[model samples]
Target: MSKHQLKAVYVISVAAELAGMHPQTLRIYERRGLVSPARTQGGNRRYSDDDIELLRRISELTDEGMNLEGIRRVMQLEDENVQLRRELEQAREIALHAIREAERAGARGGGGGDLVPLKQAVAVFGQRPSIFDRD
Candidate 1:
């Protein structure tokens, strides 16, 4: 199957129809600061796929007995967690790639030295006295 295009924006009515909600409900969500729709030159609101998905999430949270304020806080925390996870994953990938690149460069330099174990990279930077040091 082809990948879906998420770049398109729907008008308030169309978005409401797609989300199984009324246009006024969408406006209420905007008023609650739950979803921010884009504005056209004529100042009409346009809801993107992401906005619709957020609306659905807000609806689900509300259905689950969460107040609007609680939903807002939950959504904020979820967004932050997702961002942090992405950053951590990216950092891990970069570290792994750097290790591979360094190994390749070392192999080409004709050092013929044994490859250091992954655990030793931290020690290579020098032993800073740690408060938790047992030794």
Candidate 2:
């Protein structure tokens, strides 16, 4: 986890105040699997900035008339979407880097020996030409 993800300094009361929620509500949310705060050695819950933002998001979703289960599913999908976007970005970067390397190799008089050749073909979609209409 990153430093921001692990930094949990705010106690429950302070976290609730920051999130504009009651302490008990935070407990309820925790039980519902909405927000998970860190814990101290004494088993005291400690909220991170990420947790605070998540609480705020939960509040917003609650106000939007979504049930707890629906909110959980929505948050799960959103997390998946974020992960997919990150993977896509990484793939794009790798492809671009490969293309640049190929261009540099070609510019340096390399015969493109590292590359594989493929055949190309074209097709006319709508109607066959008269040249192909011979019976």
Candidate 3:
């Protein structure tokens, strides 16, 4: 978590004020599963900066006439999109590292008979095996 996300410093009232909403409105949002603020040891709700930003986004979506369920779905898809992008970036980095290792091995005369290049092909297996077929 980023520093802003790690620090749940704002109380519900302060968060509501920052998000341009009433405190009760914040509670309603929580009840609707729109926002989940952090809880203190005493069970008080504490909002991080990220939470405030999310509240603002919810307010925007609501102002645009989206229902709560629609907003929740949109948010879920947005989070999934971000996670997929991160995973793709990590995969690209891993591929590049493997390519570099292969290049280094070839440079040092290590790419000999030990490593065989693979030929990728598709196999169709719809037909059943027959005793007449030779191995």
* Residue 93 displacement (Å), model 2: 0.7
lDDT of 1 at 69: 94
TM-score of 1: 0.68
Candidate 1, residues 29-115, lDDT tens digits: the string is 889888878876688887888877888888888889999899999999999999999999999999999878778878789465547
- For model 3, residues 37-84, the per-residue Cα lDDT tens digits are 888778999999899999999999999999999999999999999999
Model 3 TM-score on a 0 to 1 scale:
0.76
- Would you list the rank order by TM-score, best first? 2, 3, 1
Tens digit of lDDT per residue, candidate 2, span 49-123? 899999999899999999999999999999999999999999999999998988888888788445776554455
Q: What are the models' TM-scores? A: 0.68, 0.79, 0.76
lDDT of each: 0.80, 0.89, 0.88
Model 1, which residues run further than 4 Å from truth? 1-8, 105-135
Candidate order by decreasing lDDT = 2, 3, 1
User: Cα-based RMSD of the predictions, in order?
Assistant: 7.3, 4.6, 5.0
